[model samples]
Target: MSVKIRLQRHGKKQKPFYWIVAADARSKRDGKYLEKLGTYNPNTNPATIDLNLDQAVQWLHNGAQPTDTAKAILSYKGALLKHHLDGGVRKGALTQEQADAKLAKWLEEKAGKVDTKKEGLSKAQEVAKAKALKAEKEANDKRAAAAVEAAKVEEEVAVEETPEVAAEETPEVVAEVAVEETPEVALEETVAEVAPEETPAAEETSEETEA
Candidate 1:
């Protein structure tokens, strides 16, 4: 029976999680597994992986064939390298202590790289968030300025319309003043004409009496 190292799908749609497993080659993809090695979560920025390194190496040593994606996962987690080192140790090409030391050093370097990547991603996220906030603030400021300008225009229009309304009423005021003054002027003229006519008639009567 051929055994294969593969991944079993789990988690929700679009956000995939997986279990690294060793299963019979003829078994259904997610149906039966010989042993679960670890888990893989791709929802994170760095793609979180948790693998049992010793178990993975042991399976590789036992001739368990890894699928393409599983191979990459195993390689990334240093399982393949550990298997190779173990092979060298068994072949007398390297001592067990030396192989262990080399594996420890490589693991340290890989961890450092992962840390740097995580830090870079975090910084990028912060920058993007700040930019979004700045854009929103600018949009709000533009809207506020527009509102203020609209208010100013309305006030100016009201000020301009006020003169037109006053101008419209101005004619009525002038007409009233004209009507009040005209009555006084006409009365004075009538009194002057009557006095002149009566004076002339009195003089004629007096002359006739004397005659």
Candidate 2:
């Protein structure tokens, strides 16, 4: 029976967690497994992985084929490297002490790289947050300036309209004064013409009475 080292899917939709296991290749993906190796959680920053290193190495030595993703996990957790070093030792390519020293050195370098990547990610997040806040503040300031400009325009319009209204009222007042003066002037002219005719008629009547 062909045994495969692979991941079994679990957790809810959009949020996934998995179990790394060795199972028969013909078995259902989430069905019975031969051995539970570890767990993998992709939700975290660095993608959390927990593994039983000795069990994983034993399984690999037993010819359990790992899927591509599972292989990457094994490599990341140093299982694949450890197995390679052991093979090198068995083949007389290197001493066990030398292999262990090499692995230790590689792990130290890998840890340093991981730490640098995490620091870069954190700095990038802070910059993005600051940029977002600055953009929001700038937008608010622009809106406030636009509001002030609109209010100033409204005030200027009101100021200009008040003078026009005052000008219109002045013309109406002048027209009213002219209308009142015209009627009084016409009455004075009529009284003066009638008084002259009355004086002429009285003088003619007195002469006829005396004759």
Best by TM-score: 1
Where does candidate 2 clash, by residue pair? none
Clashing pairs in 1: none
lDDT of each: 0.97, 0.95
Q: Report residue 83 deviation for candidate 1 (angstroms).
A: 0.6
- The regions of model 1 sitting more than 4 angstroms off are 169-211
Q: Tens-digit lDDT track for model 1 on 1-211?
A: 8999999999998888999999999999988999999999989989999999999999999999999999999999999999999999999999999999999999999999999999999999999999999999999999999999999999999999999999999999999999999999999999998999899899999999999
Q: What is the TM-score (0 to 1) of candidate 1?
A: 0.80
